[model samples]
Target: MGFRDIAMFNDSLLAKKAWRLLKNPKSLFNKVFKARFFPNYTIMEAKHTSGGSHTWNSILHGRDVLLRGCWRIGNGKAISIWQHHWLPRKHPPQVLSPMVDSLADAKVAILIEETSRQWNHEMIDGIFTPMEAKLVKAIQLSRYEAEDSLFWPFTNDGIYTSKSGYRFLKAEDQSEVEEEQRANLLRLNKTTISSHQIAATAKERLAEFALTIPRPQYPRVASTPFQTRWLPPSQGLVKINCDDATFKDQKKSGIGVAIRDENGMVLASMAKHLRQLYTALEIEAMAPSTALTFATQVGFHNGILESDSLVLTTALINNSTYLSTDGLLMEDIRFNASYFNQLLYSHVKREGNKVAHKLVRHALCILDFSVWMEDVLPPIRSAVLDDIVGFS
Candidate 1:
């Protein structure tokens, strides 16, 4: 059966007379109130106990009266005359006026007004708490009213009636105030000196030290030594390998590079951490520089410098501007690369550069200087080396 048919069948079990009664407005109202409010209100109780209780009994009674008035209106009855006249106006005045009078008599109202004035002086004078001023006010007002002094009962010396009084001239009080002021002055002096010292140190240490260094002049392509000679037949074609090294949290980083020839053998391998923190592009440049430096040092000037960082490879090939934003380390990479007479830098995918990647990972794991050499280098000429060899 459909949903409406099911609902009709469910309702059909109810007696006809009862179902007709449910249609009446009064019946609906009774049902709503009985289901919603009646159970909660019927079970609520007001009992006084010895434990700490709220002082405002009239507030509770006022709320109950308001709720009953609402119930009457909901049942189609007019609000009571007393509720209409007194309930709207009486309780606020009764509750608030007594509280105001009590605060005024206790001199708390004056104390509150004077607190802002005292706070301003305290901020400038380095004294913060209002306890002393509050005590003074209490003492003076108690004497005026001829009441028992609350603060005096806790102190051996009676309260000073005036600043010119002999009690104010006592040595102990003067000495105590002087000692507190002296301590505060010393603290302020130390803080000022410390701040000035930090500023001066920063001025001295953080200022940039720029040096003028001569840029290397590139030799004519024909005059380059690597261009003048061909690779020996015994020396296989050049292959470039590139990879990155990672430290703990991958925060400290280094790049590893190796140059090999066609026979799957290593010609030269070098690894060095970028002395300063570097972005991926800088790391990529460092990898090529490492390979090129190794190649030049070992007299293999004609070699490919491969890198996993495409951006760095492109920048090097195009001889684009190198940014000094990462500080001198980026410039250092460029300076180092200028020494390579016949360098071919290429960007290779990480998968294609697995050998150098493994070398970097190995260097990081070893935590010491390492070198590997093979007499028979790889045979591929001008080909990038991508073979990853397991560490033995």
Candidate 2:
């Protein structure tokens, strides 16, 4: 019943982003990353610089899929004749014929008529084999000098979607995926994951578990419902609690985020109202990226991110099954995640996520987005105080 690999799905999701980088040269994401990683080169020609991120490495690994896709030549100035995949119906989507020494480093622009925007048949014949010349002449040139773009032949519309990319990756590299990755699981459960970066969660859960063991039948004393309330992060790490609200009638949604330090004091809180209709599930899924972005904006580079949405929390985990369930959403989530030094995704019950929920309830008063520093909104003030007072 199951046949997909998490690693391959991860690659598939990241693969489609190559097209984004190629298409939108001026986007903020492209400008920031391109300046640091690629610098004055097209994404197709970009190399991994030393001291780059693991996320960047994983993204480049997916470029092979994009490499196999052919460029639909238009201006052709953007595409390389020899290195890029532009030839039609070829297995490698490039000229199989050996390149002549003179044309070794050329752009497809040189093979086209300047004003007419048509292929130069004479040039094609002189440079390539007869078969290659025939195929080159057969490819239609755009009349309007439209920009060059990549196309995946495996897809009917010549566009790449994560689902299609996943299927393609599964067929292309079955041997590379491991058994555990296929199951979307981890063996960390049986092992003690000791790391200083980890929030003090293991001990908390272990202490809670100690309360439930059958051997502990001492005089029954009343206990605070700490398990049902918001908890602070480990001593140094901050925690961001995220939640969402949906309006069915007006068809608008709201997102709320509460960022707090290990001392349980509110560092910042965000409430933004959406003008468009969205389902509860969709809005909940939107919370993590919003929260992470807010954290980055406010200068918190690393922390614990808690959410009531099990789907999102699990999806945020590496190689988790829910990750593949919403590949595109997680793609954006992972993109935002790379902005952090260390971030941990934690799943909390709805009861523990009240502060953010309260902020969502207060979203109706705000127009687009509202953020408060070193304070809580009046609606969530009580919740924040209670949380701080309750912390052990």
How good is model 1 by TM-score? 0.34
Q: List the residue pairs that clash in candidate 2.
A: none
lDDT of each: 0.41, 0.76
lDDT, candidate 1, equals: 0.41
Residue 69 deviation, candidate 1, in Å?
Answer: 72
Model 2 weakest 10-residue run by lDDT: 319-328
In terms of lDDT, the best-performing candidate is: 2
Model 2 Cα lDDT, one tens digit per residue, 270-351:
9999876654545666778789989999999879989988766775675442211123344456778889999898999888
User: Against the true structure, what is every candidate's RMSD?
Assistant: 34.4, 19.3
| Per-residue lDDT over 159-220 for candidate 1, one digit per residue giving the tens place of the 0 to 100 score | 11222122222333455666677678887884323332668777766553322445589876
Q: In model 1, what are the clashing residue pairs, if there are any?
A: 237-381, 261-378, 261-379, 262-378, 262-379, 262-380, 263-378, 263-379, 264-378, 265-378
